[model samples]
Structures are given as structure tokens and as C-alpha cells.
Target: MATNDYTAILNELKGEITNMVVSSASAYADAAKHDAQALLSDMDANLQTWTQQLATGEISAQDLAFLVKTQKDLMKMQALKQAGLSAIAVDKLKNDVINVITSTIIGKI
Candidate 1:
């Protein structure tokens, strides 16, 4: 194949990859919004009493460890949610890249 042909194929692949990136970004945004809302709701439901205790300075030293653990769990969940969203985007990106390469090769042949 000519160099120009190769360049054209690459350009086409770039366009396809750009579209995939946009779609993945949109999906990630939607999922992140949903997950964040759920996280907020869960926190509200689970932590109101804890929050009140801390606010009132009534939390015993014994309970402090439990509160710390609960907070660590919350942080872990947030990280996992972000990782999940990133994985989804990455998967979409990989699939799009593969499809683009396959099509370019087959079409050239």
C-alpha cells in the first residue's frame, strides 16, 4: 500500500477513536452522576446519627475507631466507583480502536 493510503487509514482510525472517546466520556459522566448521588444518599442514611454525635461532641473514644473504619469504607467505595467508570471508558476505547484497525486492514485488502 502507498504511504498516502496508510496515512488515510490512520486518519480514519483517529476519527473513529475520537467518536468513541466522546461516547465513553458521555457514558462516564452519566454513570458518575448516578453513583455520586447514590453515595450521597447512602451517606445520609447511614451517617446522620454519627454526624449528630460528632457535632454534639458525644461520640465516645471507643466509637471513634468504628467511625474511622466507616469513613475508610466510604472512601474505598468512592475509589471503586471511579475505577469502574474508568474501566468502562477504557473498554469502549479498546473496542473502538480494534474495530477501526480491523476495518482499515480489511478495506485496504
Candidate 2:
């Protein structure tokens, strides 16, 4: 059996996260934008699996949120770190990304 394609939903999430990072860190827009893409890229495989599970009713919204939050520990956002964004700023950006992920996931359902 073929798995359902989730490219559109993932793309939508990527666009939202990229836009949010660029706007939220105007001073480091370029670096932040790159970070956003990298973060999404790192999460790509898990996202595909989770999104598919969510769509198939194999995972709850809460499960998706929790799973995503757990991935935060793995998010380095190297560009943001190298660009001298404060720890607080990086944390905020991570939170924003999580929010975007959750919101985007739910909105698509």
C-alpha cells in the first residue's frame, strides 16, 4: 500500500515557520531564516511520520504536540547561535517554531 503524501502540509508549515523566524528576528532575519530551514530539515523525517500518524488517527493532537516539543532538545539552530542571538531569543524562536508546528498541524486537519 502507498502512503499518503503530506508534501503540501509540510510545505505550509515550513513557509509559516520561515516567515515567523524572519519577522520575529528582523535584526538577524537572514540567519534566522536559514536556521528555520535547517530546523525543519532536521525534523523532516519525524514530521512526515508524525503528520501521517496524525492524519490516520494513529496519534492524537496532544501526542503530536508532545513529540514536537521533545524534538526541541535536538534543535541547535546553529545560525542563530553563531549570529550571536541571545539564549532567550533562541529559546523564543524555538518556542515559536513549536507553536507554528502545532498550529499548522491542527489547522491542516
- Quick one: best TM-score, which candidate? 1
What lDDT is reached at residue 24 by model 2?
66
Write the residue-wise lDDT of candidate 1 on 1-109 in tens digits. 8999889888888887888888888888898888879877876765777767877889974686698688778779798879986987788789878888898889896
Poorest lDDT segment (10 consecutive residues) of candidate 2: 1-10
Query: What do the candidate models score in CA lDDT, each in turn?
Result: 0.81, 0.77
Q: After aligning candidate 2 to the native by TM-score, how far in Å is the CA of 40 from where it should be?
A: 39
Q: Which pairs of residues collide in model 1?
A: none
Which residue runs does candidate 1 get wrong by more than 4 Å? 49-68
Error of 1 at 58 (Å): 16
The list of candidate 2 runs beyond 4 A from truth reads: 1-5, 27-85
TM-score, prediction 2: 0.40
TM-score of 1: 0.66
- Screening candidate 2 with a backbone cut-off below 3 angstroms (N, C-alpha, C), the clashing residue pairs are none
